[model samples]
Target: MSKIETSILVEAKEPDTETLLVLNDIPLDEQVEGLIRNHKELNITRHRSEKLALSSGPDPTGLKILPASSRQRFEESGIDVSRGYPEVPDRSQIPVFVDQAFAIRNYDLPYTERGKNADKDKKSLFGAATEVINLTKNVGTEIVGLQLENLTDQQKDELALLIAERVVVFFRDQKLSPKTQRKLGEYWGHVEVHPQTPQVPDLPGVTVIWNDYKIKQGMNLNYSNNNLGNWDATKNPAIGNQVWHADLVHERQPAGYTHLHLDAIPGVGGDTIWASGYAAYDKLSDEFKQLLDGKEAVYISAHGYLDRDDPFSGPKKVERVHPIVRTHPATGWKYLFVNRAMTRRIVGFSPVESDLILNYLFDVYEKNADIQVRFKWSNTKTGYGTSAIWDNRIAQHRAVWDHEGKDARHGTRVTSLAEKPYFDPDSKSQRESLGKYLHKWE
Candidate 1:
């Protein structure tokens, strides 16, 4: 009975092509049109015979203009299009590495063991260090009065040793850029280029640590479900717990020193907790230790790839088998290397049997609060944030998503690829070496 016209005339330009006219099917409400007209970035060119609309921004080099998916998403939910269109990476110039087979990345690229000749009687770092605050009994240590970027070679070496012993070390007031952070990681060993992680455009090795940029509206960064690795808990995919995991366990040579320099943080909340692998191992019964000593488990990548063995099955995760128990080369101490997130199934064990034993080990790590240290991040938009450089070899860490990513929690992380995971039968446990014995029933 009636011929109808719609709203929102968005003029977009395609790369190497002519201009495109994009519009909505239905007419916009007057209230929504008023909001669009008021936005400084958006302009009302003209809409329909009965309604007004908005014009889109022009396309730039390597980034062709597309329909504002973000704007559409928000508008459908009764939100005004105040933010800008989100830009997706072309990934043609710089792409993510997905085929992370052990053979390709397993080759050695100059890695010397840290703390090999450590001085046991170390009190200060190059005479400028004021304190080494042990945040907890077993895991975290915060070094004060020394900046990470300005450390001498010897100081860095000692710091590496400290990290090897402490599991994780903290540094405050670092003003290092992504490149500087990359340089710092180079001193440790081979900086890893993550298989499927987004890197700093200019710097490929350094990864943006806190990835909450699902919908970037103007200056705002909306969060996605940061609780990724945790599988299930309550009915119908209830909010699963954050996973406790070591980074890059799927690599041929796994991650060693991981430096996360948080540049921005929330006013409060969003603390990360790390559990001592040594303590987790010690918490186990002697009999269980004997069972898992030399055994290996399959660790699948957090970024899954199509299983080459079974291509018909949708996206099979890349897997690397590593010892369940590994000894830290620098500390020469045995620690429980298996994590709750990635360590899938033990080798030679039936599916049910692997779940039974691995679940027990996971419980031992997750249930013990005493063996863990929770560190609250203190960094803001004003300056560089607090930094945590942890030895991933003997630690399992989980980010507390209590803030649910409402606040800005972004950082630059560089993970140095250490030697292949190894188990030494001669190495003693941290407790055994330090003579800290406990009487407990497991």
Candidate 2:
């Protein structure tokens, strides 16, 4: 199909630090005053260049300290003497925050999603040559030679479009921190915050993806506990363990783009697999597609809890009705939306009939080698591992538990809630629209 895409690699010629993501701890207005007040070495009135380099320290330890007399000023809010000074950062590299935007908050608020027009910015935002590797013809793309932290707002928007078209786009060697990742999710849409889920202290929407759901254990410091990998290849995949589903299907506005930045991964098998919804929809017959279009189905939450009022009763699952054959707002293509794990039943069918149809659909997704791509969570030279950002609007994903908890796996996820599942009657299939070559068997 589409002439078997191949991976291309381009060596990075020159690196630029000005484009790197920065915390911007020092505000421009306070920079001079704080430096003069805190450090007695610098002349306050000295002319500064756009970019400044600090004079190297004379000591073998490469540490700098303010004079003893300046210790009195440290008691004030802007100054601190408790921590030793790390190297001074270049002034030009600091990020500028526009005061106009709202600060990130935990509470619920209305937000709109982007990429409605599906206008993909195919041109590289950085204007740098990069290795673009397509894992498969229809799904999964790996962007090498560029760091996620170096992207601009326009670049991030372009990246979003790329994810919409490719199903999932991955990046290696990303230096994105949890706070920055949450900020990135905020830029995409209203960040979906799970109060029950463990989160970073200040960052509300970012969910910790530690193997064990415990946070009090001091960052899995007691490594003896979380080493059990859930998936066992010897046995049939446990429905509870290897469940394939989209995130937040039970929410009124389900997940759009869910980004998982994996910082810790096993030496062997913690790879994740994603199936292309567009390709899955294309594989169905015209009659089967017609049967599913405009139909509604029930989706249940992954984790269930006891109802506060009915403690004696069993756990109750949260269920929501969504379209069976849904259309992605960006691509305008219909995809089969039901998953074996979360999706329960077709609205108008008998339980017997629904199970038969759903089993076949799940087979279509699970059995097909052509439509699926498995990503190895391999790290780059930086050793921090990879970041995978996928559109939950039109794809299903599953984590391979084969790593068996023998090793530790850790990550932070930020899910951006998109619009409710919808169907566009006028939209067409990807194969039909693009005139892609069908496999010999198809």
Candidate 3:
């Protein structure tokens, strides 16, 4: 290969004998030549050749010796060097030169008509048939102009892609029944039967989340019997509402796509917030990321669920170990898997050490508002039919309990079963994977 010449402008001061000896000992590559100077500011030129010899004199203070290919040596000596020379500009700022460029002959017409032909030729996947509105830059997207009950196979596949990419997708004014809701979930995967929550009487896999304050009824009957002692709703309602978690994390294969339709919501309260797991993982520092790499955590089912003898609650005291950092099977992006509801402790760390690290990790999800999106359910005036489908692998959701004595908030949810949680070494980060969709609105 031909010699590639390069010069670095280094701003350095005169060095003492010991500093000069340290600089001279720096090893150079066989294909590099160094030209060093001892002036107030030095310019070092490196080319493809053998290493240059150091100056040999009693007073080597003003020695002008070239350094080899080792830039670290100069950096260690506190010398600043330029990587390369600046490029010269080739374009002029003159307007007359620009006016001679290509111009539209019909520029005298209206501005809107200038691109009329181009507008007619544009094409897209959904065309003008469907409208998609992004709820936030990170987590949720609201899709309009299509009903969930009547979706074609192609539209079903497209909606699945949107759910995977956006983390959660919302639909307004959806008139879907419990059986139809279960049918909608079947397009994605097998509808999961919730272990703890009560299912609909007629429908098999559909779970009901009913919070009727009028009859003093709660979501889970067992929790109502215990007066919600696990959450301590009377003492601290804020803490009770802030349990962010994915559904059935104790299962060997957790849920994937969860579809929830709220046909009856209160007038004032009952809002849900979702946080992006990919964003949580991306926001962590490199040191913390390396520490959590290839690590596992223990998740217990009974720890989060209040009902013990519900029969459908699977094992009463079941424990499963999953990767702390898991990769979404569909998107192939890494996301933080530990949640405040199910995850107990890190697998290998001591009790004190695990608590410290897990608390810091939990704060990353709880405190960061930039990575979260809050969605409020529609009231009775709006006809009370709002549905949401979310990817459980890349998101964690929490319900806000502000409608304590005001009204009732009831909903039907169906979860789709997915593969076991696993880490993919070749997967990209959440930010890297969703860069295009995050800026779709802009």
Candidate 4:
């Protein structure tokens, strides 16, 4: 017989003669059952016993999927640890919408500033005009009249919270350089690096969300009429502006907010709409809740992999499976967590079943305009600016593409802190309040 593969024994002792049975020669499930029937508890769990001898890979008992070092210990505990375990975020730790908003608004505010340091500081870094405006008892608020191009570190910290609270914030009449725009984004957190865009030389936070032609220095061809397949943002970069998404939700840490400075406006239609997930969940029937209670979704970006300019080719994709109904960590509210832009499937269902459910959810987001509010743009002969901030955890938004030439519409964008998106199922009161502002679908 070939040499047996065994762990090193620290102290040499009499090995069990029965333990030397040709187990490898026989099937493992058979061996386990045999040991169990013999009532040999010690033999039941061998040093390197496979968790599931008949099964193909690692077992899915939640904790085994933790960070690298923990998984190693699980292997030592006689559990199979060969395959990589997927991240399963803690559903119980998700934050509520209003609480998240409050945290963001309060990040850098001074609790007490009455010392020599206080006198030295003329004013807080963020100017008065840039402070976040709380509008209602409901958590929706506005961050008015600030130029994000040159924000202070404190302002960036505060702005990160703002984005985390409101998925997207607005700036009216922003006039700042792209370099500065990129700089402000750095203060918040990691900026997503689009696979297709050409790197901006020394720029760290400025990841290009470019199409094939742009990366190749090709002409600026408008292919806005392309059909969407996988809903990955990189599938069609320009069209990214048209969908509703929490930036890179599949990522371990997703974007808290996206800040746009609207400098350009179409003469006719250039409006963007936002929908509240918290409001949407509150409006659902009890039966619907039962159906979605334990369901999870698979978010994928394979469509981006197919693009020639994409950084990765073939099956190289980014995917995330998250609970469909999640509780916000900060606010303790339950929310419908799927989005048209990233969510792809429902776990435990066949492909057909998953598609059907995902389609239904996507329609819910599209047709239920009541939970959404639309922000329209108007071009003034006199140059001016306008902006709106909406919570991403509980909000969905889409931009309108209708426009005319010679009407000059333009804008700058600065993204802030990409943090792990979370949910809370217990915060029902705030979610209920959102129903009052539901938009009537036309």
TM-score of each: 0.74, 0.68, 0.62, 0.54
Give the alpha carbon lDDT tens digit for every residue of 57-134 in model 3: 111221122123112222343433342111111112100111111121212211111111222222321453376778
Candidate 2 local lDDT, 49-149, one digit each (tens): 11112322122111132223222222321333243322222322221111101111313456555655433655654354377888998899998877776
Q: What does candidate 3 score on TM?
A: 0.62
Q: Weakest 10 consecutive residues, lDDT, candidate 1?
A: 45-54
Q: Give the range of the ten consecutive residues with the poorest summed lDDT in model 4.
A: 47-56
Estimate, for each residue in 1-442, the C-alpha lDDT of model 4 and write its tens digit.
Answer: 2222222112335675334243465444334333332332322121111111111122243223233332332343343434422211121121112222122222332221111122122244335464655433323455555665556656555554444344445555544444655655554444444322222233434432222212122223233442242254345442434566555555544444455544445557667777666656656676777688767777654122122233123223356666788765434457778777677778998988877777677667767755566665552323554544444556666665454222333443444443344444444534453444433334
- Model 3: which residue pairs collide? 34-66, 35-66, 36-65, 36-66
Angstrom error of the Cα, residue 180, model 2: value is 0.8
Model 1 agreement with the true structure over 1-442: per-residue lDDT tens digits: 1212234334447764443233445333332332333332322212111121212231131122222322232244353223332222222221112243344476666788766676654544636687779998888998877777788777778888999988999987666666667888998889987533444444557765543442232212213544533442111111222567788898888899999877666678778899889999999888888899999999976543333344335434568899999998888899998876678899999999998898888878888998899998874334556889999988888888778666755666899989888899989988989988855666
How many residue pairs clash (N, CA or C atoms closer than 3 angstroms) in each of the candidate models, in the order given? 1, 5, 4, 33
